[model samples]
Target: MSCLEIMPKLGLTMTEGMLAKWHKSEGEKIEKGEILFEVETDKLTNEIEAKESGVVRKILVEEGETVKCLAPVAVIAGENEDISGLLKEAGVNGQEVAETKTEEKKSDNTAVEAGPKKVVVIGGGPGGYIAAIRAAQLGNKVTLIEKEELGGTCLNVGCIPTKTLLHSAELFSEIKDSRNLGIDVGEVSINWKNVQRRRKRVIKKLVSGVKGLLSYNKVNVINGFARMETENSLTVSKEGGKSEKIDFDSAIISTGSVPFAPLIPGIGLEGVIDSTGALELESLPETIVIIGGGVIGIEFASLFSSLGKKVTILEMLPFILPPIDRQISSMIADKLSKQGVSINTGCRVTSIEKGENGLKVDFTKGNDNLNVEAEKVLVAIGRRSNTEGLELEKIGVKTEKGRVCVDDYMRTNAGSIYAIGDCTGKIMLAHVASEQGVVAAENISGKNVKMDYKTVPSCVYTKPEIASTGLTEEQVKEKGIDYKVGIFPMGANGKAMISKEPDGIIKIIADKKTEEILGVHIMAPRATDLIGEAALALRLEATVDEVVTTIHAHPTINEAFKEAALAVQKRALNSVN
Candidate 1:
């Protein structure tokens, strides 16, 4: 008798999982407890072990294919056993599903319905899902297509997860010093597993809310890999079923970015992982060596260091937070150094090697060759736009440097097709992507809108969060703009001082002639939340005098903003100018 293996439910809330990789080849001898495959669910990869010993007969699901729970994905049987009937019963020929995925191009000749436009959005990230909801709100029939989980990278592996963990770390740090505030506290240690469990719960709640929104807005969601069959048509492939053809009057490609991996030796080694892997690690390694000192690495450094983990950051550049203002970047590096984070900027890593302890990283700075060893290595260089499976080139959708090319209105070369979010490589932030999604959806619904990049804010959620909007001082200098700089330390703010979180500074740049706010950069607590004011000021083209005269409430962190604005004209009250 043959044994059928289906996609098992890994969690109560997981309706489906992506077969990330098969650990064993077809026809390979199987062991009862040996690893068989990996299933990605809840943003974590879980190894699915073989339940019974048998020769593998067939693998029905392909890698990257998403399969629903309880769906037969493979078959194993005793040698010489009749498996044909079982295969027939399971409806998994493998070849049949493969054939359906390679079907011919679908023509965009569907009869137009008089009621509403038919819209299909691929990739349910912050961008894609938001676009679907907006389109539906505009009286369009919307279908959202996602290969794996919704909420995309931001909710799963990127923004939400990082911030959640950071909050935990911050709370732990706060408790360690509670006695200083005259509060009696006993020993408190992080229940790491509980922290992990809570992170998962938060994510599940938010994802369910997003899905609920989609349902309420009347957006039909297809869970499968989508490939473009035509400008107005797509072929979605499921793990254990025939391909589905979806046609629309318009489409959106929000398929976001994947971690940019360099071709260095030993990068594929056992303990070397990417940003997503770092987020899902079950336990803290004794020490971690992170490559690249960009926003991702810096945030991770903040996270592990707060928990008293040994962390070393290696960067090829001259400084960390490369895009930030030079002086503020230097300040952040110093603060992180004070936190015991070993930062080696201008250190070019030539290769990573497996070491006796864990992993060895070899690099050189100028004439010096150096190395560091740690329990794990994280490659956090950056991200690249995901555009492979969409088949953009086949339909004349233009792309530059592997990113989908779109105009100000998010329209691709094909007028009926559009792309947004990380895939377009426009500002690779979730908020930016969400705004772009709105712009794209509005344009599709017969509204004219263009994305304004000038006021878009970028934030880093490290200890003493960093944020910026508009032109940096260096950029203004390069543009030959006449600018005046105002600076105020957070320690000068009464509210910040009282809260015991007074570390870092605020720097504002204003045009000397126009007195208009050219930029606002901060390295202070809750900078991510505070940057919204700067974004709005830039959007409204507000001037220094306007902010200074706004009469900020007393003993509030926001008063620092007005003080910094006053410093632009050398009239600061609470702080010396």
Candidate 2:
């Protein structure tokens, strides 16, 4: 079916409007309700969305052109439809002009072209997979190369598996408290094998879904390790001596990261394992010693301790989760202590040795020797960029501190090559990698973009999940910025009582003069999900009053945000100021 576009009438007296901007260009395919164009009326600019799905065959009135109300402005028709008669009826000679403009759009890369160039992406992590899909959408022939599996570390061994196990642990923890929730019956036990099986299934399903997404985007996938032969050339050597060479117009590297294992005596012992080895545990250990106090360390501590293990964490820093707010970290530490998890901060591990029955870890706390024996030891110190085989040096790609160097545009020193995700070492989170991938792809496809980290949220999957975005109180103090903080406890939240999770609080920091929300930190149930609102408020430069005035859902954890906002001005409703 063919549909003719017309200048929409805004008010009864309105007679004309100026075509402001076209969201979809001529020959662009559009779906129903997609913003097709904007019109400037006497009152305001209004976006006109497509009423039906079709291809934009002709743009009768060019942008900035004035057209009378109810007059034809464009023509939409089914795919490959002849719109010559419609153009003739509208008294418009736009076919030739539209064709020429479309020819220009094809070269620009913002629009789809008939002859798509090649885009070879190394690594099939979140960043690489997303970039592959994006480039494919931009009418580029995208080929994604991976050595082991799609979804990279995040899906195979990192984020997905960790979170899945965390959820299982959380459930078991809840079951252990079933009596308090008005449940009389229960003998709860940690079925570690079943939990591992479920986590594996979830990961397998997601990896398969990622494959489907790549397939849907028409991206070709190669199962092999890829190495840069030159700036524009790559060689992939598959198993059984199979190898192939690929050339590309532009390339992206998102090889992700590997667990950083430092040089320590007996670090390579059978019982000493990194984060990946922790996930592949054959059976639950009765006693465990975790060798770091960062995000990875705390998370594993939470997991094993919840599942009935005597988990001990050793940190060389003054506080666990050093990147988090000091107050929040202390509160979480206290909570973990109450849960039987021993946290040793400012403690440095000197060496690991074979104990009489198990592994022994020797450490120091302010020059005093300390030792802990455990059935298993996990080294969750940190992660480093995994560039073992890509041969970034082959193409003269610059790197800094063991990570590929890239500009704000995510482009490497080589103009045709770009790097994002863990390979660039920017924060090393999967979500961050995904966004950086989009930025890199957009820039390659003729879009002006830059990666921003100001409002990025960090989440830790502890018992009471910790999440924060924007500035921290310490940062404000260091900068000497006058700021005020508001805090609301979960003890007062009705949902918290119903859910039996009234063990945390929400804190909001804002500028004193401007009242703009500068940061939000939460240590509560579902804090990971609740932090999105705070991130958005900070991203939009919204004031505490704006968030306070916005009505939050009744009897929910998110209401803590509103009350916290109100408390910033000493006007909290549910809590006494």
Candidate 3:
């Protein structure tokens, strides 16, 4: 039988890569260790070498096209050997390859759905809009309703806006330290107005993009608040006393979330603002006190501190980023402290009061009562699911602690009703919601799709960004799994040293008995982008040896991930074992 040559995983985090060039054509003889093709990822391009000596039977994947990691890109065999089965297995028919699995599922679903369904999705956020589009693509008549802006909180006031500001903050912080990199640029200053303007521009562009996508998908979008009267019927009320009734065979609720405001005294004061208000600040404060030490709070702390604003964070939890791996969280805390951000954990905010300087934040740490004065106080405590006016109860849809309840398929208790995203309160990240939306839409389209949270990646957009996927060390211990850990410091990475960003580490944890990779945590430059590969690893149940054998491009930050995997077996080449 002819052997298949697949697109090799070039790095630990790489799920797919672009076929940049082909060194060998069909029928060309190639030897082991000879360059076969070049693959390009966001990090770097690497020439992939052949593993077995053979004549290239057929080039399955063309250059400039992207192929998934481990998917057959070409078939290699000896002269006169039959390779028809290999090409068919690679989804090659003549010169055309198969469409994506999602598209294939849609085609199957279209065949299953003898008639189009009137699918209604409430709220135009990441979850709602995605579900609406997917439902439409699955040959359904889909309608989406939202009172505020399209793209919901994430695009309007959450992820997009916050990341935009953080990018500016990171730029300013980097330029200030650029002299150390032999770039002697003097007089670094932040133009706050321009920063805010750019943030708005980015948000506007994203919101417009979402609108365009909805239109292209043929999803009917309504600008109003949706209230469910029955499982199959709802009413949408618009501004200026306009109302319309919508009847559908199926419905998806994706109302998203709102920032939770604790009942601390003076929380409603002028200077005390929630995350939404913080994003809309007219001017940057000289000093800011952010209450909460979760992802949102830590990101804002990074933003303000990087811009030379005095930043203080108070958290009721014993530690910051409690959901993250303890070691990674501790490292981030240390870095934030070094950057002059004061993080006070295991503290409860008593009150916010007006003071001589700007605003006084009073909190207690154990037996000590402490106060910090700042120009503005931001409440980043957390968010609660936004199910207001949804009237899910009217339709007998169950809700737990103000969040919609749903099954793995995102179906609600009420017949033909589904819920996704923050409204369900199952992992509040936008990406999670989007996936849940897909699950809900596909299920509604007569497909058996379920949402999986096992490999969801959590990201923190701070200096030396943090991202993690799969079980944490604590969770693994609680589950009583015997696991081995590997750690690689960025100080030893060539790219980190060249970029002067050698202040993070990549950690990998795998099952000792089976060598299955259980978790991957990273706090390095481009860590957010790097987590995708880790997520794919977890999804595919990749083993430590699998990661170690993957060829990582030299002189790149991604090589640290491979080194970390090697460390799992005490055999890391570039770092101390």
lDDT of each: 0.87, 0.87, 0.88
Model 2 score (lDDT): 0.87
Would you estimate the TM-scores of all the predictions?
A: 0.80, 0.86, 0.82
Relative to the true structure, candidate 1 reaches a TM of 0.80
Q: Sort by TM-score, best first.
A: 2, 3, 1
- Cα TM-score of candidate 2: 0.86
Best by lDDT: 3
lDDT of 3 by residue, 1-577 (tens): 3688877886788987767679999889999889999987655889889878889988876654555688888888888988777867776532333454345347534212324699999989998899898888667899999898999999999999999999988888889998877789979899889999999899889999999999999999899988988888999999999999999999999999999989999998889999988898888899999999999999999998998989999999999998999999999999999999999999999999999998999999999999999999999989999998788788899999999988887887776888999988889999999989987886776555667789999999988999999999999999999999999999999998887789999999999989899999999999999998899999889999998889999889999999999999999988889
- For 354-423, candidate 2 gives per-residue lDDT tens digits of 9986999999999799999999999998999988878888889999878999887798889889999998
Ranking, lDDT, top scorer first: 3, 2, 1
Cα lDDT over the full model 3:
0.88
Candidate 3: which pairs clash? 13-533
Error of 1 at 362 (Å): 0.5
Error of 3 at 179 (Å): 1.2
In angstroms, how far off is 302's CA in candidate 2? 0.5
Q: How good is model 3 by TM-score?
A: 0.82
